[model samples]
Target: MLLIHQLPPKPDYFRVKIWRRLQTIGAIAIKNSVYVLPFNDEAMEDFQWLRREITAGGGEATVCRASFVDGMSDRQMEAFRPLADHGAASERLPGTGKAPMNKRGRTWITRPDVHVDRIASAWLIRRFIDPKARFAFGEPKAGMVRFDRFDGDYTYEGDRCTFETLLKRFGLDKDSGLRAIGEMVHDLDCKDGKFERHETPGFERMIAGVVKRNPKDDARIARGAELLDTLYESFPAAQQRSRSH
Candidate 1:
């Protein structure tokens, strides 16, 4: 399903707000001002909200339930959501591909701008979800699994951040050391005052440095992964103790 909107120009604020809203629902921008999402009840509701907002913002919008024939472009055909954990059923449209993938070789998608939660989530994917996972940015495509992009299968849900959701959903929550890192990510990303770890300030500075140095998403992720690996190894005794069975 696609909720396409043609917004008025000049103000820019309207476009920004609409783009953010579409991002929240994991809508891929197939073309300028045209976004795509899987047809579902939740997706429909999200589009309804967006439609209302767009209309109220002096822009015109419409939601359409769509299906594609064969020979669609890869980007046009890509799935809009992340795949479920192993053994879980994956819903797919005809000609989209097989459902419920058993392994994690799929390309892990996210926004290009890396941050605390996004970087941490990417590290988690390589370290725990899929070691050989490939990565891309900006709207998930068919056959690719996305995280940290609006309603992604592995992204934020309810009160949980993407990192926390990945940890819990993939059964990685048992690792106290990872959970410790997750607390930092949650506090930094959400600013919700949920965790009070003292290492946050220094860690955030380190992340900022990495992001500043590595301008490209692929490069930043590689650098970020190294830092996360080191941090996991150097967790304090309390966190290490939590790792014990």
Candidate 2:
């Protein structure tokens, strides 16, 4: 699916809003004012909605199906693969409320080598989402809940890392400290510097040191959780409470 649009130049905020909507739907830009998403029912619906929004905002928009032949190859397309296949699986748990009680006590799986995002996500699951969340690093089983992996139940959404995704999905986004930590994790894990929080550099170095010192995933997650706990508490108590409400 392709969404091509031209917005009126006067209102700058409208342009940013449209861009963010595109990102939320996991659209990839191939050219200026042109974006691509995997041709699927969800993608088609998303593009249609964006087209309407653009047209209503005093913009011209078109949604169409396109075949990539000349400049883009299948391999390159794979690089920007859409989340359609995994979207249905992830929807089993909605973000409308708190983490579901039925989701507790399940083994969460991920890639063996734990890093900043995985460690933080694991900590989040244990600390807030599920106190008894058991983690395993290997091939996911039939009933295992996965995180940070491509087909996981919880993973990246648009530009968000797994930690940010989990925070948003589990109704934890209102907490200011968790939101700040999510920004730091996003900057470190995605390496995009979208949120260059002043604390991100130090957080990254500390996580790197944790990975270097801990050879096991369990140890890495344990050490990383301690760091994250301290960081979360470092925020002013009033600020955290005010936003959490």
Candidate 3:
């Protein structure tokens, strides 16, 4: 969960300034008058700076930890490294929230519209055609898991456009644990599907969730996808973790 706080009344100009600064450090605005922010040193620092800005304008200020989404977990914090590791994901910083961090960046690869395809293709290409991830297309298999599973009805469909079908033909529906993992994946994957203008930076948070909540596994995809043949039978623990947060 991310931490957030309400802002005190300030000039519109000052409020916008604070809003942009918080956003630069990965804060989301849930209410127009109140901005949702991550609970962390950076966000706290941003809030302090915000306090100064508002006070300078002779306006009131308040910074409180949001119960619903004040901040992410410690594990999620580590996921930022790999995300920033990507050149494109790095460019989003220090600016307005309209574009991806970088133009040549690979942020769009994680889009919900592309989620199903990306997982299936990455699994197939890496394990079968391009083992060792030689023909790289996605993030390295270090802090992430990849597979198509059931999450509501949308994520259950598996790879929609893949030439290698892993759904009805594969009978993944019979799997019991598949659904749970799917729900988390669906919620996390489509982070961009219903994305609002204010939630553009949310991709980083979703990816952070995926990596943090996923159970660490070895040799899942690149090793001929054999790991998924057995391990993919179970859903990840993301839902439970998310709910607790």
Candidate 4:
């Protein structure tokens, strides 16, 4: 499915809003105004909704089925695979490719535009799982491990965010500070208000500032790691904090 759109130039916010909507639906951009997604029912519905929104915003929009024969390669086409199919079929492993569970010095790939859960998860990976982990942002590729995305080795399991998933998967859930931080990340990322920690608001603000100030993913991760480090130190174990309250 292709969504080609031209938004009115006056309301700059609308353009940003449409771009975010496209990102949320996992649309990949081949050009500035052309976005594509796998042609499935869900993808078609998402494109339709986006087309409506674009047309309503005093812009021209068209959603159509497209097949690339010349400009796009077979590997590039693989990027449009549905999110669920990104992983392997092996019961022992859940990532698109195989990597040792405790492997060090491997690149961790995730979706672009890191946010609260991605930042915290990256911090957890470096701080606990792999000290020398390298991070990359983009679609899943052969032999690259993924996280914080559909079918990733560590992704959302039920209501848990990637941060919480990583905590349990790596046997780090026993740490109190990590658990506390996970709760805050869960509430903020899931937007379910499950934890409602008093520090959540402040943490959210700080994360927003970090993302706003740091456009590069590596910079955001560096800045966010510092913030999470301070937060981890400030927090007692979950049980200790609960007992005090």
Q: Which candidate's lDDT is highest?
A: 2
Candidate closer to the true structure by lDDT (higher is better), 2 or 3: 2
Query: Candidate 1, which ten residues in sequence have the lowest lDDT sum?
Result: 85-94
Candidate 4, which segments miss by more than 4 Å at Cα? 1-100, 237-245
In model 2, what is the error at residue 160, expressed in angstroms?
Answer: 0.9
Worst 10 residues of 2 by lDDT: 85-94
**Best candidate per TM-score, number?**
2
- Candidate 3 segments exceeding 4 Å error: 1-12, 69-245
Q: Which pairs of residues collide in candidate 4?
A: none
Candidate 2, residues 1-245: lDDT per residue as tens digits? 88999999969977876776666566789888999877876567567656766776799989999897678754575577543322211111112334455788889998777888889999989988889989998789888898876555787565567888898878888878888999988766655468899988898889989999999999999999998888887888535565787
Q: For model 4, state the Cα shift of residue 135 in Å.
A: 0.2
Which model, 1 or 4, shows the larger lDDT? 4
Q: Rate the local accuracy (lDDT) of all candidates.
A: 0.70, 0.76, 0.36, 0.74
Whose TM-score is higher: candidate 1's or candidate 2's? 2
Order the candidate numbers by lDDT, best to worst.
2, 4, 1, 3
Model 3 has an lDDT value of 0.36
TM-score of 1: 0.58
Model 1: runs farther than 4 Å from truth?
1-101, 236-245
The collision pairs in model 1 are 78-141, 78-142, 79-141, 79-142
Give the CA lDDT, 0 to 100, for residue 212 in model 3. 48
